[model samples]
Target: MSNPTELTHAPHRDDVGARMGMWLFLFTELLLFGGLFLVYAVYRHEYYSQFRVAALELNLSIGALNTVILLTSSLTVALSIGALQKGQKHLSVMLLLITDILALAFMVNKYFEWSTKIHHGIYPGSEHLLNLPDGQILFYGLYYIMTGLHALYIIIGLVFLTIVLGFVITGSVNKDSYVKLENAGLYWHLVDLIWIFLFPLFYLIQ
Candidate 1:
């Protein structure tokens, strides 16, 4: 049988390993987005005018509102972790719940935004899009691909946050052992960071 003392130390090692693993996973995500950004840059250089026109068709107000939502959600995640570290479990859970709400708000806003676009026949592979010039077609193509991927990431992050919230409530993550919460926070931040890049590239281009 394993020594009781050794068993006690096992979680410490596991915590370190978990953190390293999360970082590795996030690094891979960055690579994926980096490649997409490079593609966007290449195409934008060739179709700057078309890209600008397509961007103008996007609703800046909705994009800006989603940006604020994600930024606020990131803040709540940070605060949740801090609250847990300070042994305020209830407060931590509350903050995490707030983060979840903000995430859902972002998604709902995106839903409406996408619906509006699609209603106007502005989505990928639509007849209207295909009828456009090559440059304009490429612009909408990248916009959908990038923003759609970002929205998927947000959903994934929401799942992670929800799971971590349960762990926190059940004491699986606590002040003494909160590696799981930290990992979830890292993932959420990555989701937010990707959007920070996406919002500018797709919505605020000159």
Candidate 2:
């Protein structure tokens, strides 16, 4: 294996140092999420019928719409990176701005989705859900646990992206060094990936 110190000494051309560290971080993050997914799979199997029934309450169309929004945001982020590579500062910033807008839109959708469910007495351990079957309650319990954590990570990813955009706007970053953008994008893509799985698992009831 390569020496750890050797890795750090890589040339910093185009913010390569930052991106290298970010890629490594993303690998670890994926492993962590993998464990969570494993746990979810076990629980899902134990309560398959309940999960299926509970999933019907969620609007698949909304989940699908969010998926499209996240994918489009990812694409915009990609375009931003490409613009930076081409030394087109204005174009890169424009794309970043679009990303910010998309992030806000995503949060808006999430809020409405969650709130609508909450209002409909779909939340776990709520008085409103007092009449729900135990299995259905368990299904919603897992749903809240999984999706809540995912949402937290999405917020964190957005914060990181916003910080990177701030750097870009303040001239601390530029076309020659957009590794931070790439790093932030990695995190954003992870958020997107999680939601992709979440959509099918939580919204596609047989």
Candidate 3:
């Protein structure tokens, strides 16, 4: 029979394997977004003028504010990981909570931005949108599709961070076993990286 001591010991964790799996998952996400980028490039090329006009319709202030928010959140997440690595559990948890708040702020800003667009009749398939030229119509379609997907990613990342925060609180993730927090940090960075690409694509098309 296995020793009682062995039974009580924590199970061996494959940190390397876990990290590799996360990277692979991140690569697949990149592939998915890459395809959308290609489509955007193709359509934008054909409808450059319309794309610019459509881009102008987007709220620059909100886009810029969200950019700052996500960037700040990324910094906080990185700091949280560093804090955990250095055995500062309380600081790590605090920083992570700040990151989560920033994420929620980003979502709130997005809600207002989308609300403004919809209120202005710029959403997909609305009479005003449909009445626009084909390029403009296509522009709004892609806008909704890409930005909406990005928002979904933000929500997913929030859930991951929240769960990891719980782990940190319970001492499940500490200096000796912080791969979970590190992985969560990587995922949050990916979320920020995607927005870095998306901000320019949808907001700064001029």
Report lDDT (Cα) of residue 3, candidate 3: 41
Candidates sorted on lDDT, descending:
3, 1, 2
Q: Assess candidate 3 and give its lDDT.
A: 0.92
TM-score of 3: 0.94
Each model's lDDT: 0.91, 0.82, 0.92
**lDDT: worst 10-residue window of model 1:** 3-12
Q: List the residue pairs that clash in candidate 1.
A: none
Better of 1 and 2 by TM-score: 1
lDDT assessment of candidate 1? 0.91
Error of 3 at 138 (Å): 1.1
Question: Which lDDT tens digits does candidate 2 get at residues 1-206?
Answer: 55554566844354566677888888898887788778778878888887788788887887888889999999999898898889888888899889888888888888999999999877877896768776677768767887888878878988888898888888677765667888888889888888888788778867
After superposition of all CA atoms, the RMSD between model 2 and the true structure is: 4.3
